[model samples]
Target: MSSSFDKFQKRRLISSYFSVVLSVFLVLFLLGILGFFIINSKKLADDFKEKIAMTVFFKSEANDSILKAFGGELKTAKFAKSYDYVSKEAAAKQHTDIIGEDFLTFLGENPLQNSFDIHLKADFVINDSIEKIEAGLRKNIMISDIVYDKQLVNLVNNNIKKVSMWILITSIFLTIIAVLLINSSLRLSIHSNRFIIKTMQMVGATKSFIRKPFVMRSVKLGMIGAGLAILALIGVLVYLEVNFPDLGILDDKLLIGIVLIVVFGLGILITWLSTYFATQRFLNLRTDDLY
Candidate 1:
């Protein structure tokens, strides 16, 4: 009966350890999903910002050569990404296409100024940066006015900032929750070994010596859990890519690699810390308390 009881206890311990690993896997899996959404959202935001263009209209007195020179100069500027020059005729045609009539004929001549639409680099798409660029451009006599959707710029930047802040707050909150949950699971698993800890202590085992084995076990569990979670994350990513190829979120190899590394690191760190503390608690307990 005593031998059977010991065998049963060993089986229960193995079961409890597996449960802890599964719990950790679930927690890390959730974090991985959140990371995927965050990375894609940032990529989309940069693409949106990079597409915003400022139309620099030239003065009528400014010849084609002058407008052409401005375009060439913009290419050398760090802030400018790319540009398209629209001749007066092309601008008039565009306006006519929109209005469904020949506006130049009504005005008796082509009143539309030759302009170039300049796309700013992603980092320079903010209101403050555009204001500075506009001020510098104003120094040129041949330039008439710069036109862009100021309200759109304001809306996009403001929304991006809010979304970023929320993501950051959410990430932090989830991380704390992850630690608590993983720690709790690990504590329960360690609780089964409380008697073992006390026995080691009574036998003159140094705390470090007793703690080392448990910590190593925790590390092994964490690596296995993290690996399973990463596999699940990869599976989800593959499913999404296969079913909805247009999303293109999984295209960023470097970001995906970083996220996986983070998941793996978090799993190991949280488990190790929890195991170390949990073992310490049992070490302080009386041998009778193991019952």
Candidate 2:
């Protein structure tokens, strides 16, 4: 009977410790993911902004050198990220490919204009900045007209703002939920020791003396849980690097280090506080209240 009781107690100890660690691990993993998204939000916005292109068409009277010079000037512009010059012939061919017909031959002339497809940097891709860029482009005598999707640019900006705001709200909500869950789990783990706490009280043990072992155990569990979470997060980043190399999220070492620090620090803090409070409650409970 004595041996059976001892084995049961040992099993319960292991089970309680496992439960604490698993709960902390889950919460830490969630916060780590939130941190990753928050850090990469700028990169994502820039990527979407690159889709807004401006095509500047030139008049037939403009010579090749003049048009090329205008393009070179655009390269020096503050708004321009890059530009691709398309000859009239190439534009005509591209149009033909799209329409699936030789419209140039049918009309006995290539009506297409030499154009530059300009991609603006993220800073200058805003709607107001686009007007400034357009005004600057129009000042060039070699340019006939600048064409861009004003509505598309506006839509992209508005949508990106909405999405970013929503993501930030969601991350904050999930972080709160994760903290609560970890706190509750740690409290419950300490709650399981109510009887032991009462027994220690009957033996005239000091509160701190009784609580020290539990607090140290909780801290150890927290460290283990945080280490596991960091390892799991790293595994995910490695997978992304191998399979989705273009994402580039894994390249930011500073952001990765920040995430690891937050997870490790949070795990220890939450576990320590929860353990201390829960043990204090048990220590103060009357014998009948504990029952």
Best by TM-score: 2
In candidate 1, where is summed lDDT lowest over 10 consecutive residues?
282-291
TM-score of 2: 0.94
Instruction: Tell me the alpha-carbon RMSD of every candidate.
Output: 4.3, 1.6
Q: List model 1 lDDT by residue over 110-229, tens digit each.
A: 888888899998889898999999999999998999899999999999999999999999999999999999999999989877878888899899999999999999989999999999
**TM-score, prediction 1:** 0.74
Candidate 1 local Cα displacement, residue 160, angstroms: 4.1
Count clashing pairs, candidate 1: 0
Clashing pairs in 2: none
Candidate 1 regions off by >4 Å? Answer: 1-15, 32-45, 59-62, 92-111, 195-210, 232-259
Worst 10 residues of 2 by lDDT: 67-76
Strongest candidate by lDDT: 1
Off by over 4 Å in 2: none
Please provide, for model 2 over 74-113, each residue's C-alpha lDDT reduced to its tens digit, 9 standing for 90 to 100: 8788778888999999988898899999897769988889
